[model samples]
Target: MLIGDVARRSGVSARMLRHYESLGLVRPTGRTEAGYRAYSSEDIRRIFHVESLRSLGLSLREVGRALDDPGFRPSELVADLIRQTRERIAGEMELLTRLRRIGAAGPADWEDVLQTVALLQGLGAESAGRRQRAALSSGEESPVPVEALVEAVLNETDPNVAGALRWALERSGEGGLTLLAEGLGSPTAEVRKRAVQAITEIPSGEATTLLRNALTNPDLVVRRYAALALGARGVADAVPTLIDMIVEGANDVDAADALSALAADPASADEIATGLVGRLAHGTVEPSARRRLTQALADIPGTTASRALADLSHDEDRAVALTATYIRKLRDAR
Candidate 1:
C-alpha cells in the first residue's frame, strides 16, 4: 500500500506516518517508481501497533522503544503508565471538585470565581496559617463551600487549624454535616473523632442527630464527644456514656458538666441521679473513681443523688467519706 492507502486503511494520518518514519517508529518498506513512500503489510502492521501503544499513554518515543528494542521489558513500563494515568485522573478529579465548589458558591461573575478559587487554594495550602485564614474567611460574603470545609476539618491535625475549620464548618451551615457524618464511619479513629467534634460545633438539629448517632461509635473519643454534645443539648440518651466517661476519668469533668446539663431538666434529673448512683455502687470502682462519681452528684436535684451522697458520707475510704460529706453539706445548704 502507498502512504495514502496506508493512512486511509490504518487511520494514521500521512503526516504522522512521515513523522513516525523520521523517528524510525514505523518506516515504509518500499517506494514506487515515482519515488513515493510505500508500506508493506508488515510495515502497516507496525503502524497499527504504534497507534495501539500510544493509546496506552505511551509517548511516541516510548512506542518506538517498545516496538524496536529487543531488550525492552513491558512490565515496568506498563506499571509506570498505570501510575501516570492514576495521577492524571486524580488531578482531573481535584479540578472537577474545585469547579463544583466554585459553582456551589453561586458566583455571580468572574470576580466571584477568582475569589472562590483563591480561597479554595488557601484551604489546601501546606501552611497551617493559610489553611486557618481560609477557614476563618469561609464565613465571609461568599463563603467557601461546605464540602471543602468538611474535608479540611477531617484532615486537619494542627489544633488551631482544626478549630478554625470547625468554626468555619459551623458558619457554612448544615450541609457540612453530611460529609462529617460519613467521616464518623472512617476507619481512622482520629478522623472519626474529628468528625464528632466538628459536628459538636455545628449547633443544628441535624448536627445533634449526627452526634446522637455517633454516641455508639466504636472509638471511645468519638463516643465521648458525641455524648458530651448530646448531653449539652439535653438529650437523655447521652446519659449512659456520660456516666461511663465519669467512671473512666476520660474528660470526666466535662462529662460531669454535661450530666449537669441533662440534670438541669427536671424530667431527666432523677434518671441522671439513678445512673450516677449505679456506677458509684459498682463492686470494682476504686476509691478515686468513687470520689469522682461522688463529686459528679453535686448538681443532681432529686432524692436519689442526695440519698446516694448520704450513704457515701460514711464510706470506708475516708477520702470518699469526707468528699461525700462535703458534698452532702453543700447539698444541705442548697
Candidate 2:
C-alpha cells in the first residue's frame, strides 16, 4: 500500500504520517517505482499501533520509544499516563465548578463577571485575611453566589474567616440554609458543628425550621448548637435539650443562660423550672449535676422556680442543698 492508501485506511492524515516518519515513530519500508512513499503491511500495522498508543495520551516521543525500544517497560509509562489523566480531569472539574459558580451569580455584564471571579479567587486564597475580606465584601454591592459563600463557610477553618463567611452566607438569605443543611448531615463532627453555626447566623424562618429539624441530628454537638440557637429565639422546643445540657454538664453555663432567656417569657418560666426540677429529681442525677441545676434555677423568675428552690434547700446532697439555699436567699431577698 502507498502512504495515501495507509492514510485513507488508518485515518492518520498524510501530513501527520510524514511528521511521524520524521520523528521515527513510524517508517514505511519501501518506495513505489514512481518514487511516491510506499507502505508495506508491517508499516501499516505499526501505524495503527502508534495511533492506538496516541489515543491513550502518549506523546509522540513516548510512542516512538514504546514501538522501537525492546527494553521499554509499559508499566511505569502507563502509571504516569494515569496520573496525568487524573490531574487533567481534576483541573477540568475545578474549572467547571468555577464556571457554575459564576453562572449562578447571574452577572449582568463583563465587569460583574470579573468581579465575581475576583471574589471567588479571594475566597479561596491562601491567606486567611484575604478570605475574610472576600467573605465580608461578598454581599456588599453585588453578592457572590450563595452557593460559593456556603462552600466557603463549610470549609473555612479559621474562626475569624468562618465568622465572616457565615455573615456573608446570612446576607445571601435562605438559599444558604439548604447547603448548610447538607453540611449538618456530614459525617465529620466539626463540619456538622460549622453547618449549624452558620445556620444560626441566618435569621430566616427557614433557617429556624432547619434548626428544628437538626434537633434530631445524630451528632450530639449539632443538637446542642441547635438547642442553643433555638433557645435564644424563645423556642420552647429546645427546653428538653437545654435541660439535658445542664444535667450532662456540657456547656451547662451557657445552656443555663439559654434556658433563662427562654424563661423571660411569663408563659415559659414555670415550664423551664419544671424541666429543671424534673432533672434534679432523676434517680441517676449526679450530685454535681444536681448542684448545677440548682444554680440554674436562680435565673427562672416564677413561683415554680421559687417553690422548687425552697424544696431543694433541704435536699439530701449537702452541695445541692447549700447551692439551693443560697439561691433561695437571693430569690427571697428580691
Candidate 3:
C-alpha cells in the first residue's frame, strides 16, 4: 500500500506516518517501480500499535524501544508508564487544589470572572505545550498549533472580568508580559504579582529598575515575586541581594527560590555556596537559612555543591539531614 492507503487503513495521518518512519518506529516494506514507498499490511498494523501506545501516554521512544526488542515485555512497560502517569496526575491534582483555594477566596466580581477565563485559557495553552514537548521528545509528528494557539490566547479579553483576562494573556509568554507591565499599579496584590511575574519572564536591563523597586514593596508576597522575577530574567547582579535575603531575610521560601535561580548560573552558584558554607561553619546561619542554602548548593552540582551537601547531610538539623539525603540521591543518579 502507498503512504496514503496505509494512513487511511491505520487511521493515522500521512504526516504522522512520516513521523513514525523518521523515528524508525515503522518502515516501508519496499518501494514501487516509480519509487513511491510501499507499506505492507503488517506496517499498517504496526501503525495501529503505535497509535494505541501514544494514546496510553507512552513516548514514541519508549514504543520504539519495545518494538526493537523482541524479548521486551509490553505488560511491564505499560505498568511502569501507568505508575509515572499516576504520579504526574497526582501533582497536577495538588496544583488544581491550590488554585481552587485561591479562587474560593474571591467572590464573582469582574476580577474573578477575568481570572476564570484566563485560567481556562492558560490550562489550554499548557496542555498544548505539553503535547508538543512530548511529541518533539519522541521524534513524532505532533498535531499542535504552536503559533496560532499562542496568538489567540494572548489576544483574548473580557471587559467584565476586570484583570482576570489579562492573567491568561500574561502567562502566555513574552507578549503577555507586555500586557502585564501595563497594569503594574493595580490595587490588588494578586494583580501586582501577576504583572511582576510576567515582566520578569524575560529579563532585560530595562526591567532591572522596575524589579528593583518591586523588591522593596511592603507586601511580602510582592517582594518574593520580584525576587523570583529577577532570577528568571538571569540578572547576575541580583545574586548579592538574593544571598543577603537568604542569610538575613524572613521569607525562607522566596529566598530558596532566588537561590535556585542563582544556581542556574555556575559563577553565581559557586559564590553563594561558598558564602553559605562559611556561614554554616561559623554557626551564624539559622536553621531555615541553612536548609535553603543546602538546597541551593545541591542544585548547583559541582565540587563546592557536593562538599556543602555532604556536610549538611550530617548536620544536627533533621531538615538539613533530609535535604542532604535527597542531594546524595541526585548525585548518585548522575
Candidate 4:
C-alpha cells in the first residue's frame, strides 16, 4: 500500500505518516519500479499503534520505546498514561481554583458569560465536560464558582489569558495593585513568575522594582527570566546590574544575554566596551572573557567601539580576530 492508503487504513494523515517515518517510527516496506514507496499490512498495524499511543499523549520517544520493546505490556503503559492524565488534571484544577478567585466578583458583564458559553460550545460540550470531569477527579479548583462551567478566561493556557488578567487587575483600581503584589509573593513559583510578568505589562514604577528584585532570585532560571523581563521593561537602572552580571557571573550564556540586553543602550554599550578594553589591556580578564568582551564591543555601534575593535585586530585569539572583522563592518558602514 502507498502512504495515502496506509493513512486511510490507520486513520492517520499522510503528513503525520511522513513525520513518524522521520522519527524512525515507521518505514516503507518496499519501493515500486517508478520509485513510489510501499507499505505492508504490518506497517498499517504499526501506524495504528502509533496513533493510539499518540492519542494517549505518549511522546514519540515513549512510543518508539514501547514499539522497540518486545515484552511491552499495553496494560502497564495504559496505567502510566492514566497517572499522567490525572496529574495534568490536578494541575488544571489548581489553575481553575485561582481563576475562580479572580473571577468571583461576577462576570465583567453579560457579554463575558456569553463569550465563555460560546467558547465552551465551540470546544463541544462533551469534550469540555470531560475536561471538567478530569479536573474534578484530580481535586483541582474551578476557575469560577460554577464548577460545571468555570470561565476559562482566567485559567486558560493561551498567552492572551495573561494579558486579560493584567487588564482586569488594572481595572480593579487600588485593590488590583495589592492583589498583584500579593500574587508576586505567592508560594507558587509559577504564580510569582506570572505576577512579575503581568506587573511589568502594567507600566507601573513598582513593576520595575519587582523585576529588579527578581533578578537576584536564588534560582538561576528565575534570574534569567527576570533579566529578560528587565530588558523588556527597558529600565535604565537595570543596565548597571546587567553589566555587573556579565562581568561576574559564571553562567556565560546568561551573562552573554544580559550583556546583549545592556548593549542595546548606547551609554551602556560605551561603558561596557570601554571597560572591556581596559580589562583586556591590563590582562585582568581570562581569554574567553576577553573574547566575549570583544564580541560585546563589536555589538555597539559608533567610533568608540569600532576603534576598540580596530586596536584588537592583531590579538592572537581567533575569536578576537573574528570580532575585529565585525568591527570593520561597522566602521565601513560609517
Candidate 5:
C-alpha cells in the first residue's frame, strides 16, 4: 500500500505517517514506481501498534522506545501511565466543579466570572487568613456560590476559616442546607460533625428541622451537637440527649448549660429537673455521673428541682452530698 492508501486505511494521516517515519516509529518497507512511500503489511502493522500505544498516552519518544527497546520493561511505564491518568482526571474534575459553581453564581459578565474565580481560589488557598478573608467577603459584590461555601466549611480544618464559611452560608440563606444535610450522612465522622455544626449556625426553620432530623443520626457526636444547638434554640426535644450527655460525662459542662438553657421555660423546667433526678436515681449511675446530674439540677427552678436538690444534699455519696449541699445553699442565697 502506498502512503495515501496506508493513511486512508489506517486512519493515520499522510503527514503524521511521514512524521512517524522521520522519528523511526514506522517506516514504509519500500517505494512504489512513482517513488511514493509504500508500506508493507508489517510496516502497516507497526503503524497501528504505534497508534495503539499513543492512545495509552505514550509520547512519540516513549512509543519509539517501547517498540524498539528490547530491554524496556512495561510494568513501570504502565504504572506511570495509570498515575498520570488519575492525576489528569482529578484535575479535570476539580475544574468541572469550579465551572459548575461559577455558572451557579449566574455571573453577569466577565468581571463577575473573574471575581467568582478569585473568591473560589481564595477559599481553597493554603493560607488560613486568605481563606478566612475570602469567606468573610463571599457575600459582598459577586457572591461566592453557596455550594463552594458548603464545601469549604465541610473540609475546613481551621476554626476561624470554618466559622467564616458558616457565616457565609448563613448569609447565602438556606441554599446550602441540602448540601449540608448530605454531609450529615457522610461516612467520615468529622464531616458529619462539621455538617451539624454548620447547620447549627443557620437560624432558619428549615435549618432547625434539619437539626431535628439529625437528632436521630447514628453518630453520637452529631446527636450531641444537634442537641446542644436545639437546646439553645429552646427546642424541648433535645432534653433527653442533653441528659444523656451529662450522664456520659461527654461535654458534661456544656450539656448542663444547654439543659439549663432549656429549663428557662416554665413547662420545660419541671421536665428537665425530672430527667436529671431520674438519672441520679438510676442504680447504674456512676458516682461521677450522679454528681454531674446533681450539679445540673441546681440550675433548674421550681419545686421539682428544689426537691431533687434537697434529697441529693443528704445522699450517701460524700462528693454528691457536698456538691448538692453547696448548690442548695446557692439556691437559698438566690
Candidate 6:
C-alpha cells in the first residue's frame, strides 16, 4: 500500500506519515518502482501502532521510544501518561468552574465580566489581605456569584478573610443559603461551624428558618452557634440549648446574656427562669453548674426568678449560696 492508502485507511495523514518518518517513528522501507514512497504491511502496522500510542497522550518522541526501544518499560510510561492526563483534566475542570461562576454572575458587559474575573481571582489569592479586600468589595463592586462566596467562606482558614467572606455572603442576600445549608451538613466540623456562623449574620426570614432547623444538628458546635444566633434574634426555640450551654459550661456567659435578652419579654422571661430553675433543681446538677445557673437567673425578672434566687441564696453549697446571695442583693437593688 502507498502512503496515501495507509493514510486513508489508518486516518494518519500523508504529511503526518512523512513527519513520522523524519522523526523515525514510522518509515516506509519499501519504495514503488516510480520512486514513490511505498508502505509495506509491516510499516502500515507500525503507523497504526504510532497512532494508537499518540491517542494515549504520548508525544511523538515518546511514541518512538515506546515502539523502538527494547528497554522501554510500558508501566512507567503509562503511569506518566495517566498523570499528565489527570493534570490536564484538572486544569480543564478549574477553567470550567471559573467559567460557570462567571456566567452565574450575569455580567452585563465586558467591563462587568472583567471586574467579576478580578474579584474571583482575588478570592482565591494566596494573600489573606487581598482575599479580604476581594470579599469586602465583592457585592459592592461586581456581583460575584453567591456560590463563589460560599465556597470561599467554607474553605477560608484566615479569621479575618473568613469574616469578610461571610460579610460578602450576607450582603449577597439569601442566594447562598442553599450552599450554606449544604455546608451545614459537611462531615468536617470546622466547615459546619463556618456554615452556621455565616448563616447567623444573614438577617433574613429564610436565614432564621435555617437556624431553627440547625438547632437539631448533631454537631454540638453547630447547635451552639445556631442557638446563639437564635437567641440574638429573640427566638425562644434556643432556650433549651442556651440553658444546656450554661449547664455544660460552654459559652456559659454568652448563653446567660442571651437568656437575659430573651427575658426582656415577660412571658419569655418566665419561661427562661423556669428552665433555669428546673436545671438547678435536677439531682445531677453539679455545684459549679448550680452556681452558674444561679448567676444566670439574676437578670430574669418575675416572681418565679426572684423566688428561685431567694431560695438559692440559702442553699447548702457555699459558692452557690454566696453567688445567689450576691445576685439577690443586686436584684433587690434593681
Candidate No. with top lDDT: 5
Overall local distance difference test of candidate 2: 0.90
lDDT of 5 by residue, 1-334 (tens): 8888888999999999989989988988898788888889999989989999999999999999999999999999999999999999999999999999999999999999999999999999999999999999987576999999999999999998899989899999999999999999999999999999999999989999999998999999999999999999999999999999999999999989998998889899999998888889899999999988999988899999999888888999999999989999999999
Candidates in order have lDDT scores of 0.89, 0.90, 0.63, 0.62, 0.93, 0.92
Residues 1-334 of candidate 3 have per-residue lDDT tens digits of 9998887777888998888889899999889999998998788788888888788888899888877888989999889988999999999996685465335434357665454434434434435453233223211121112232233323323222323333333333343334444446667666666556545544455556677777766666666667766766666555655666666655655666767777777887777677767766767667877776676566664578777787778889999889988988988898
Where does the lowest 10-residue lDDT sum fall in candidate 1?
134-143
1-334 per-residue lDDT for model 6 (tens digits): 8888988998888899999999988779988889999988899888888889888888899999999899999999989888988999999999999999999988889999899999999999999999999999975567888989999999999999999899889888999999999999999999999999999999999999999999999999999999999999999999999999999999999999999999999999999999999999999999889989999998998999999988987899999989988988887787
- List where candidate 2 sits over 4 angstroms from the true fold: none
Instruction: Compose the digit string of candidate 1's lDDT tens values, residues 1-334.
Output: 8988988888888998989999988888898999999889999888889989999999998998988899999999999999999999999999999999999899999999999999999989999999989888876685898888888889999999999988888877788788888999999988998988889998888888888888877888888889988988989999999999989899999999999989988879999999888988899998788889989999888888888889989998899899989988887887
Worst 10 residues of 4 by lDDT: 137-146
Query: Across residues 231-283, which tens digit of lDDT does each residue of candidate 4 receive?
Result: 65655455544444555544545555655567787887777566656766765
Candidate 3 residue pairs in clash (backbone atoms < 3 Å):
110-161, 114-161, 114-164, 115-164
Q: List the residue pairs that clash in candidate 5.
A: none
**Backbone clashes, candidate 6:** 0
**Candidate 4 regions off by >4 Å?**
1-191, 244-266, 275-289, 302-304
**TM-score, prediction 2:** 0.95
Superposing every Cα of model 3 onto the true structure, what RMSD results? 23.4
lDDT of 2 at 313: 86
Q: What order do you get sorting by lDDT, best first?
A: 5, 6, 2, 1, 3, 4
Q: Alpha-carbon error at 237 in model 6, in Å?
A: 1.1
Residue 118 displacement (Å), model 5? 0.7
**Model 1 steric clash total:** 0
Worst 10 residues of 5 by lDDT: 133-142
What is the overall TM-score of model 6 with all chains considered together? 0.96
Candidate 3: TM-score? 0.39
